[model samples]
Target chain A: MHILVVEDEPKVAQAIKNGLLSEGYRVTTVHTGEEGFFQAASQKVDLILLDLMLPGKSGIEILNALRELGKDTPVLILTAKDTIEDRVLGLDSGADDYLVKPFAFPELLARIRALTRRGRSDQVLKLKLADLELDCITRKVKRNGYDIPLTSKEYELLEYLMRHQGHAVSREMLAHDVWQVKDRATPLDNVIDVHINRLRSKIDTNFDQPLLHTIRGIGFIMKTEDEP
Target chain B: MKLVLSFRTQLMLLNTLLVILIYAVAAFFIYAFMKNRIESVELEKLQEQVSTVSTVVYKSGGDYNDWYHLGDQKPFLIMEDWKVSYQTTAWKDLNFPDKLTPGDFNNKSLKTYSAEQHNYLVKINFVRTGIDTMHNFQVVVAMENTEALESVEKLARSLVLGIPLILILAVAGSFFLSNHAMGPVKLLRIKAQQISAQSLSLRLPVINARDDIGQLTIVFNDLLTRLEYTFEQLKRFTADASHEFRTPLTSIRSTGQVALKNAGNVNDFKDAVASMLEDTDRLANLIHDLLQLTRHDAGRLKIDFSKEDLVSHINSVIEELKILAEEKGITISFLHPDTIRLHINPAYFKQAIRNILHNAIKYTPGSGLIEIQLRQEESGIIRIDIKDNGPGIPPDLREKVFERFFRIDNARSASVGGSGLGLAIAKQGIEINNGNIKFVDSNRGATCRMVFPANSAQDDSSAI
Candidate 1:
């Protein structure tokens, strides 16, 4: 996949380009709105990470110009303006997704995956990692022929963790996705921590090979021993 | 030219005009009355003289000289058979009328006649001679009234002459009175101009508290007091915000520097990076909370209120925080009879309840009890009480705990890990939803009491 990053600040543009490249995607970075508009209009890119604030011509003008020409590339807006009106304007101007600044890298990656994967996601009833097995239809979990009892909250947390098996999921993503909290300032870190601790003890306590592991300062990840 | 008059000048001019109008009408009436009195007195004397002359002429048997010897100084004329039969010597030089009409003699009428540039009072009478009605003659008596008219003119002259003096005095008096009345206003204006934002504590002097100007000054001083209070609050908020923001940044900076300096093993370096990242998360949360508060202060939040079941809302909040409470072995008991509907913004209301519940769980010890009671008061006010078996807040510090960045024990709160804006946000959220929250006295621990009106429309927080 090919991606284009249009950001004015050199350091932020370079950082995004490096991060996208490390994930095995061809990355192109542009520093001005004039050049960004040219590249987006002509270049063959699958997804575009466009910043709203830029020098010379603004990001909105570029987005408008490109959209007026019927370029159907999926545009993800990265902006510092998070007011309701700003979000509506970006979406109304044909932005596929909106992410606020100072965002977590894991959340960004998750959004990227959701956007690029679009209609290709297929439903699977059973998920497994090493001896652990979860049945999506029955809402049941088993490891090495032993059934595990989990609370409703524990079940939901484990399911989300298992869906993003190898990627580390930040607390903000869990708070928003699982708890459905729209306000980012809510102090739900402790609650998430407690639920994760319980889920960990239940799933990995009786087995020699632990599938769920903490990524220290980041968050939780579910993977077998040899994955990383 | 369009003339704009000062208030005091307008008052003076109006007063002076009123005085002049009243004085001119009074002088005109008094002059008319005096002139009339002088003319009436002259006419009465003329009639009496005419009677005396007729008697004299009759007694003397038609001898005009005998009546003339009575020494009447005024002019006289007699007409008989429609001809001037006799005339006084003075009457000839006075240019008296040639004839006295017989019609006027029938009633012995008196009339004013003007001849030779002088006004006269003329009295005509018909008298019988020697008791014979056939021998009757008409007597006409005339008096020169130019001197009397002149005296009245003199009186009018004096009256007219007094006007300018009276007008001068009226204008001066009005100006003096208006200047005296407006003296305090001038002083007030000068004092008010001297006060600025830096001197908001300065008060305008109240000359008389019961008067209009004094009342206005008092109201203005009250406005200044409120402005000063708001200014102080803003200053403190700025200082506290900067301090809160600095602490996390300081930790992040120091941790990053120390990690780079050590250059230790891979795992050790990873631990340092993780510590720094933790501080970064703290900073980010603080910034987000600050933005929310500022947005609320700017009145930018779009709040839509609707009727919802209060019991179910609280149940959901409790359910969300149940795991955290259970992890510490704390038991939460909700005591409510049935569903109670209320008008509120569900999002803000739920956040407030969640914050308060989280606080209870954080403060209570292991195996402690937390009770939430929901009921309607007798006055139709819906009340909710959240009480926990933790250390109770003191009476003096109850209100202070809701202030931003206020923690009972800073060291312990730091260790417990919160941005210190939870309670502040909770209070604001409740207030914006038209409810009141306060820490009431409890025997075992802190009891938070929140009350909402039975029915209220969307309320603006700025009003409170």
Candidate 2:
């Protein structure tokens, strides 16, 4: 999947691009309105991650300009403002979705996947890593075609990690991605960690090779078993 | 002055004192004048008797005239002009301390003569002897005394004694009258006590007569009418607050339920999750804004301000919101003067400025213009103006746009949720700091301007 990120701040733009690149999405970054507009109009992108404030042209003008030219590629607004007025104008001006800045990376990946999954129907219901297969509609998971029981929180956590397979996912990222509430602290009882531990036991304990890898000091990552 | 302990008691005492003063003075003069008149009448009668006897005595020359005491015959002498010249008259028969001598009696201012050993007041006058008025020696006599004089003294004493007794009666009468006069005041006090913030529906009682108390009752009832209106407005505000709070909660819950129901596949689930995330951010913004508005309303807008780099705070906020502006193709540039450090409550001030910027960013079209400038002018005013190229406010509503729950008809929506407390909170925050916020003169789009007292570091003088 291809995505265009237009942000005025270089550091945030770099972070988002780097984050999305490792998630297997082709990310193109720009810092100015002229460049963002050039990229949005000229580049064949699956999604556009745009900012509202830019140099040559404001984000709203670029968005409306793109719509004026009838480009239907999905554009996701990444803003640091969460005002109602901002959201309305963003969506009303032809943005497919609006996402504020400093957002969780996993949420960005999810939005990218959802926005780019236009013609791929069969890819919607199935998820696989190593011999583990999750039948999303049926709410069931199978390892080596054998059923595994998982709690609701454990399953949601597993799905978030698998969706960002082979990449580091932080506990904070998981809380935001799974819970979707900002600054919402799910109590310090090791809730997310406990669920991850349970899922690790289910997906790796009986197998000859463990697929869920714990990245020390970073977070956890899931990969095909036997990679190391 | 004693406190009177009771208002009515004091009034009663004062009224009785006035009445007793008048009664004593009147009784004193009446008794005195009557006693004097009765004594004069007795003297005149004695003088007549003396003249009659002297006429007889003068015809026989050098004869003395005398009379007996009324109802008791006793020796007495009547000399010239009713003057008593007695050896012992019935009036003077009782023990008297002194007596009258016969010669040069006119030289004495008064004489006491013993008549039956009683004291009598006498005066001597010579009658005419054949044309020599001065040499006449014919005598007529009478005793000068009356029970009326003594009785008048007794009567005055008896009436004067009744002064205190009348005063007591007047005091009791005044007490009842004063208590009756104050009856309505006590009633009003009781009524006032009963009517509190909660029971504003209660009213002061009004009596039938159109008197002073009636006028006061009318005034109090008008006051109650105003209080009830205020209470109703308070109730409406509470209801509006609850309704505003419930909306964001509803949005969040519905979003969560929608996402959870459709977690069928990766793409479907991802779309649901994204939508839920959007809803979540909205909910958080609402709660944060609500708390900020409440704090501002409580007069603590400056409670959170701290000394910080004003330029950096503006830059950081702009950088944070950079992506949002990018999406809308809007330009948010900061032109803050160099190292303009200010003592500000970061959270509250940011919230205030953020809300205004949000309005500008939201209403302006993609690629629309927005400019944020913070600089100090010569008069120690730090001005912050946020301007945007959006559909500006209608002229009529520009004044009322800062009212809570108010929405500029062209600028608000339920979709991109707002509690309509953003500008209201901003206005409140600025007002608390003795600063001001206003709509700058503009032909198109909205321009919000804020003026703060310059920080000490930025001001040329030490007055901030």
Candidate 3:
């Protein structure tokens, strides 16, 4: 997998580069916003590590510029200013994820792996729970080969839950992963509830057995929805 | 002099002196002028009596002997030259006084004089044998003891007594004016005494014109204004810091809920749990610094001093910074034999030294040198020189580097993950323990120094 790190601080950038290189991923590092913009457009990078505060330009501006050019490559913002305003602005500017600095190198590695999971976007994978089967590609959903229609948000949420199958994900994780957004500005669990409700509606409404089960006091789970 | 006593007594003594001086000067000059006028009038009356005798002697065609007595109700004038001369008709004799009167000028030499009944003033005139002027005669003027001269004495008495009374009133007036002049200063004292951190908004009243007191108010009020402004800025900064801190803290906490709910691996859960712990630590540090600053504001920070070996303590501090140094491939060295031990609070003193060392290692270039020197000087002071080859602090802002919440450029980056309270805490700790810390000397980069007394009984074994 190819990743580009756009950070201004030498130590943090070098650390991330060396760390990612050790993980056997192709990593290129750039220190300027203009350089990040040019590299994102011309280079074949699967992911980008962008610092929010930069010398020449801000990471939000770069993120927005990349998005405006229809580059959907996941961009993770690395920042030290852990303020709601910065997080909101970063996500709203089309960043895939946000991570505050002074972070453990292990967390950075986890986020990089999570971000590069899209390299397998085209691989065929079917998620089956009870009678519900979702085609990973072709956007097909069926109940015993009977077709079902799902909205864009429902499909994305179902995809995220099925990717972490057999386990419950809280409202926050669901919000960040499925919504690709920060927590504060969006009414966090409320959006998660609406999308989960709609996904359950398309997948479980009028079906004989429900596959999306709500885990009380925690979040939701995509399982057989059976007691056993 | 005692403060309050001096303030009141100096004015009181000055006013008494002034009033007494004015009374003495005015009474003395008035009495002298009145007495001189009275004496001049009395002398003129004596001269008139002498002239009367000369006129009578000339009218008598140079009589050899005669008696002349001028009779009034009380005879005040008599002229004689071995005889008496007067125009004593039967009507004059019948109308004259039979008893002596005070201040009446009389002489008995004009006839069979009765000295027992006469109260007189006498004057003798001399005549030379060769001179052909009018015959010399003796004259006396005894004015009756009448109220006319007594009125002069009464006038002098009134002035002597009345002058002091008026002076007392004038002194009282001076005291009143002085008190009135101090009115604004009293208000200022009250205003100042009422000021606390809670009520820092109150300002000194500037109700008067620009005298020294008014100028004092201007300066004092300016101090108050600055204090209020700093308080307000501090309040806002704390709010901003808290608000900023809560976001990341919330993120970490919420992320924990997810990690716990999912059947995630121990490694993944540990990552999430570690982030939460880090956030809590940062939050705790922020609150701790804020509390420390509050204590400083209250002036309540105290230090307990004891034996501290600078050499051993510094080695441990350097060892503490070694973890950070190892990350960057930088090294710290002590260039001098550290033979210094002083009395200090070991915990806080060590904290100050560790902060300086940590900052040196934090800011220095990779493969750079941090040199520490400890030397004892003749002035009874132990000085520590901690120098680093790094990007030096800009000349303009060296002092500001120690202020709370003060950070230079790129201070908030991951490369320098300081809480921005290290130097502030170090300086505060240094001051609490009765030591002085500052940027002592810098060469191509920077050198900072902290010095304190070296004459204490704390042993120096760790230096070797």
Candidate 4:
């Protein structure tokens, strides 16, 4: 997928470009709002990652100008301001999604994947990684043809991790998506760690290979091979 | 010209003007009355002289020499048979212009005349010295009233002269009275000037609490007290925030420096980076919490209240944190009714209850028991108690723990991985929801008691 990034900060813009390039996506970057608008109007990018505070023309003004020309390309807004009104205004101005500043890289990747997969009807009910399998319908888990008993919270945690098996998921993503915690300051870090340890012990304690892994300093990841 | 007068000066000027107005009115009435009294008395004296002169002439048998002694002291004119028969020597110089006849006495027996700028009171009388009509004679008595009018002029001069003295006395009296009345206010001003921001604890002396100025001083002192308290809290908050910020930065710096000097392989370097990353995450959370608190203090956060099932909401919070407690072999028991609806901001209420529950799980040891009780009192207050069989907080530090960055065991808090702002944020959220949270004495462990008033805990399902 081709993504257009409009950001004035050089370091942030470069980091985004490198991250997205390594993830096997085409990236186009611009510094000023005027150049961003020009490139967006001329190019055929699949998605646009626009920053709210640009030098020449504001992100809101450009979004208005683009929408007025009837371009419906998906746009995700990145902003330093995280107030409720700013989020509402961004969405009202035809933004497809919004990410607050200082957001985690894994959280950003998750939002991008969700935004790009907006209209797809692909749903996976059963998830597998080598010997472990999860049945979303029955809310059951099994490994090596034996039933694995898990608590309700553990089931939810395992299903979320298995859905995005290969990618590392940050604690912030789990806190928001799985735990449904809205406040970023809630002291749920230790709780997430304990639950992860229990889930690891329960599934991998009696197995020859462990499917769940911790990427230390980052978050938890599920994979077939043992690697950091 | 606009003269900006002080309050005392204005009072003095008003008093002086009032006194002058009263004195002027009295002086005018008295001057008029004295003039009228003197003039009427002079006319009566002239009438008495006329009767005496007529009697003397009646006894003398119409002879001028016999009554001439009475005329010697004043002026007199005698007319017999309608002709001027006798005139006093003094009466001749008086310049009497008109001759007196019985016709002049027809309507009045007295006349007043002014000649040569001298005033006179004249009385005319007709006397019968014999039985025949020819023996009848008319006597005219005239007196100069210059001295009577002179007495009246003297009285007016004296009255007019007294005005300047009264004015001087009124100004001085009013000035002294205003100064005495404003003495307390002047003292208040001098004392108030001595108070400054550095010395906010100083109070304005109340000279008389029953008076207006004293009451104003008391009110100002009350305001200063509140300001001083808020100022002190701000100073402490700044110091604590700086310390919190430095704690994580210190760890990160030390870890980085050690890694650079001692790392022999990429794994060692990676381990150091990981540890530093953890510290940075902690710092980020601290900054986020501080921002949330500042927003709450500024009254910038919007609250949307709705009716929710309190039992289910709290049950869910406990459920969410049950795994953490279970991981430590701790057990939590929640005792509540099947349903208890309340008006509250769910997000804020959840944040508060979640933080309190998290603190309990963190402090409670392995195999410890945490009990949550929810019930409504008879006084229409909804109370929730979260008790844990852990080391309890001392009574002295119960209220202090709500302060920002306050910890019961400072050294042990670091290992607990708490940002030290949990209870502060919890207090703010609970206050916004019209609830109060405090620690109550329990026989075992710590008990956090939260209460909501009747109005806040009301069940109004139809209204949002």
Candidate 5:
């Protein structure tokens, strides 16, 4: 996946760039609204991470200008201004998603994945890792060709983890992305742990190779046992 | 403290005093004129009585005893050659002055005399019956004036009594008039008193827009509107500032927590610490900028200004920001007269120039040209234009750029290391030195122009 990050802060841009690069995605970053606009207009990318505050032109203006030019690329707004009005304006101005600044990298990556997946309807909507398979259309999970019954939240958690396989996902990431909880300080770590344990017992206990692994203190990661 | 009367009370008292003065003057004139008329009419009647008495005595051929036929009740005394020749029956018991003589009587004379607690009008007539015979007789007739005097006294009494009554009525009338006139003002006072910070939208009732009180209320409502607008702006500014402050702090906290929880090696720890340090630095910068803004708003910040070459100052700022420009591969060029002198605080001037230049360098793409041009106009105003070959600001947002905490591009500005106070601070700094700064019309790029008077008399020591 190719992603364009239109951000002005050098440190933040670098951090996001590093995070996205480590996620195995090709990333292009621009520091100004005008440059961001030019790149978005002329370049082909799967998704664009737009910052509202920029030099040369504002993020909304760029979004509007791009939409006016008939560019249907998915856009995710990342900004420090998290007011309700700001969010409404960003969404109303053709942004596909809105994320406030100081966001978790995992949550950002999750949102990016979601936005990127929205445009590719022709591709198969299934997730697979070794013997584990999940069909998005049927909302079913299978391991070694055997059906695995899962709750909606467990399925969502599994899907998110599988989408970001081989990477450490924090409890905050799970709470924010899967549960859609905006406030990260809430005590949901035990709930997430309970659910993850339940999912591991149901999916990995009866299997030869474990696909879900705990990163101890950090979060959880889903991968084949032989992989890292 | 001096005593201050309320507007309503003052109006009432003034109106009452004016009414009393007018009524008193009118009463005085009426009383005087009535008294004069009464006295003249009484004297005229007394003179007619004396003339009748004199004709009767003269026709009687100076027969003293015949004067009794004129009127028995009327007091008359005829004195001839200093001797009482005839006296009425009523004058018999009356004591007459022994010095009564014809010399005391002119052709006809009328005078008032009080006798036995009764007012009398005395008329005396002197008659000489033969010119050669020299017979002179003084006939005196006295008539009681008690009725006319009683009527005049009654009128005087009524006047004395009516004046206070009229004044009392006048007082009541004036009070009512003043109260009615000030009714709208009273309503305005009550309504204005109810307006607090929370109820800024409430307006004083304007009953009559053409009246003075109504006009005053309209003006007050306009002032309230302005105040409310300012309050809203202040609230928004505070909210935005708090949000801006919270974002970086949240980043630092979250980054630290995640780093501590997830770090499994030295490299991970180093990377986490580096990110946390970056967020912390951003937080520190935000706080510093907020503090500076607060100080400036409170007028607590002092500026030290001296006469210096403005061209060199701009060059120094440009040189300082050269590394930042070089990082983006943007070229900055300066064009100015040889030595353009201006009176300014070097620090504040440099800060202002640095902000504009930084914005230019940050916005312009790599290999884009940034130009700084300084020229002295014929009007003795020094102008500096900072133009950038970047996406210029929209026309509608040109003026809003100076607003506190206002960012055109929220997302890009966040990453650009701007707290949204750079232009606001720069505008304030330039204004403090008696200069003007604004975004001028440019065809292709953003042009920010700062104009300063060649000889600014405003010094840094003075409060702005």
Candidate 6:
């Protein structure tokens, strides 16, 4: 999937661009409203991360212009203005979603994932890796064709990881997306570790190969050993 | 030093003065009229008596005895051949002139004389008895005029007593009337005094809408309403400003705390520092914009105006902002006449234009088209219009968008990162240059128009 980031602040734009790139998505970053508008109108991207205030053009103007031109690219408004009127106006201006500034990066990624998932034609109800299988509709998991009981939080964390399978998932991402915690200041890494340890003991203890791999100092990755 | 009196006191004094003047004039005229009437009546009575006495003597054929027995007791003497031939007993007691002079014998010759310390009216006349005898008699008649004098004195006494009484009544009545008239004004003053900054909602009482005082109260109430509204708006503005500042500070604190708590690695510390730096930059920008607004409000934002080619100046600003526009893949096109010179504060003028252009670029989509046009019209106005293919501001918000801290999309504006002072500052800058800026009607995109008087450029230069 390809995403375009339209932000005027160099650091913010770079951070979002880097975050999306590390998630195995093609990302393009632009600093001005005009450039954002140009790339959005001319290029094909799965999603557009739009900033409201830009040097040349505003994010809302770009969203409106693109919509006026009949472009249906999903737009997520990222702005510092968090008033109710601002949110309503942004969504009413044809934005698919709105996120306030100082938002958790994991939350942004989750919203992006949700928006991109809706645009795809193929819908998968079941996820499988090695002997571990999760039936999304039934809320059930099976390991080596045997029922593997899992807690709700563990199941949710597993589901998010499987959605971005074979990619590195940061502890902050897991805490924000899986735990639904917005405050980044909360010390949730230990909790996330405890949950991950429990889930690992349940599925990988009796299996020959472990599917979950930790990328030291960065985050965690879920992939089979032979894939590398 | 001039004496300053309250309106009520002045009004009362004026009413008293007018009443006294009218009374004094009326008394003087009445006294003069009464004196004239009383004097004339007394003289006529004395003359009638003298004529009656002379007729009785002439009819008796020079016999004075019959005249004395006529029963008119008024003092009279008829002398013939230098003798007091006919005199009443009362006439002998009066010190009358024994030899009547010819001047005294003239008809209707009246004089004021005193008898027994009483005022009397006397008249002397000459009478001829019979044509055959050719006898001339000098008759003098005197009647008491004390009654007429007493009547005049009575009138004078009444006037002297009544004038002060009437003046006192008029003064008291005027004081009451003035107090009644100014009662509403006093009420208004009391109500106005009760209204403080905290109690601005209070309003003066309007007792009678048609009266002057009532109308003044109504006007004062209207002013209070406006003041209350302004005060409320100021309060809201202060709250919003503090909130704006607090949000970033909170974010910086949160980010730093989290980073420090999880600082097991150098990269974690680096990430925390970076986020803190971004927050600080945002804070600094906000403070800068606030300072500019404060200076503008204080009338300390100085603008040194001089004659300059506006076209070149605008061109340079466009050049400076083009790179920013190019970053978004936006195109900016400028069209103007060969040269348009106007008196303007170059820095401020450029800042205003830059703000507008920046807004257009910020709002327009990438690869959007921005068109700027400048022209000098026959009306001596230099008009500049900047049009962009962006979502135009809503019609309702066109005027409000210029207000301080006004953002159309608060949430969107936050993430986009702006101090919300760009347009407000732009407006101030333009006004300082004696120019006006407004949103023009456009079919597709937002168009902003600015106008400056070209003639003033020459006027300013000549004055310098």
All candidates' TM-scores? 0.86, 0.45, 0.46, 0.82, 0.60, 0.59
Q: What tens-digit string does per-residue lDDT give for candidate 6 at B381-401?
A: 889999999999898988878
User: On a 0 to 100 scale, what is the lDDT of residue B60 in model 6?
Assistant: 75
lDDT of 4 by residue, B1-464 (tens): 98899999999999999999999999899989989999889878887887887888788887667866774557888788768877888778788876666666677887877788898888888888953434678888889998898899998899889889999999999999999889888987887788887787888888788888778888988998999999889889999899999998999999999999996799989899889878878887888888888887898777788888889999888888888898889999999888877788888888899899999988999999999999988877888999998998999999999999999987897788777889998898788878899999999999999998887666564332
Candidate 4 pairs with clashing backbones: none
Docking class for candidate 3 = incorrect
Per-residue C-alpha lDDT of model 3 across residues B1-464, encoded as one tens digit per residue: 65556564567667777878878897888888987787667657655765665455445544534434344443433334434433234323333344323333343322212243432333433222213445544333333323435667898889877866877787787778678877787888888999999999998888754788888898888999999999987896676566647766787879888898885897787778657755654664565555565666696544456766778888866754564565567777885464566767776677788778877877788988888888778777778888989987887778878876667874343346656677888897787666778885577567888877654434443321
> What i-RMS does every model get?
1.3, 13.7, 18.1, 1.4, 18.8, 17.4
Local accuracy of candidate 5 as per-residue lDDT tens digits, A135-224? 988889999999999988789899988878877777778867786645332123445766888799889999989999986445688998
RMSD of each: 4.3, 22.2, 23.8, 5.2, 23.5, 23.3
| Candidate 1 residue-wise lDDT, A121-142, digit = tens | 5587788888889998888999
- For A41-75, candidate 4 gives per-residue lDDT tens digits of 98897889999999989999999999998888889
Alpha-carbon RMSD, candidate 2:
22.2
> lDDT per residue, candidate 2, B1-464, as tens digits?
75535776777777888788888888888887888887778677666755665565556444333222222343334344334443444434544334445553666533445454334555544556544444345342545464544576688789878887898888887878888888888888988999888899888888844899989898989989998987886686677677776775676677668777766766666665556555555555556556556654565322534566767866755654454576667888777778766666564465566567777777888898898889888876778888888988777887678876677653446744466777887787566544679887786788898888755435343222
Q: Which candidate wins on DockQ?
A: 1
For the predicted complex of model 2, DockQ is 0.02
TM-score-based ranking: 1, 4, 5, 6, 3, 2
Ten residues in sequence with the least summed lDDT for candidate 5 chain B: B455-464
- Please write out the lDDT profile of model 1 over residues B1-464, one tens digit for every residue: 99999999999999999989999999999999999999878877887888887887678666556765766465787766667877777777677556556665466477777876798877877776754444567777888788998899899999999899989999999999889888888998999999987887888999999999889889988998999889877778788888888998898888888888988899888998888778778888888888877789899778877777889999999998998888889999999969877788888899899989999988999999999999987667889999999988998999988988888987797777788889998998899878999999998899999999755533333232
Q: Cα miss at A88, model 2 (Å)? A: 40
Residue B127 accuracy (lDDT) in model 5: 78
Residue B296 of model 6 has an lDDT of: 67
Instruction: Tell me how far the alpha carbon of residue A99 in candidate 3 is from the true structure, in angstroms, after superposition.
Output: 34
CAPRI-wise, candidate 1 is medium
Pitting candidate 3 against candidate 6, the one with the higher lDDT is: 6
Candidate 3 achieves a global lDDT of 0.69
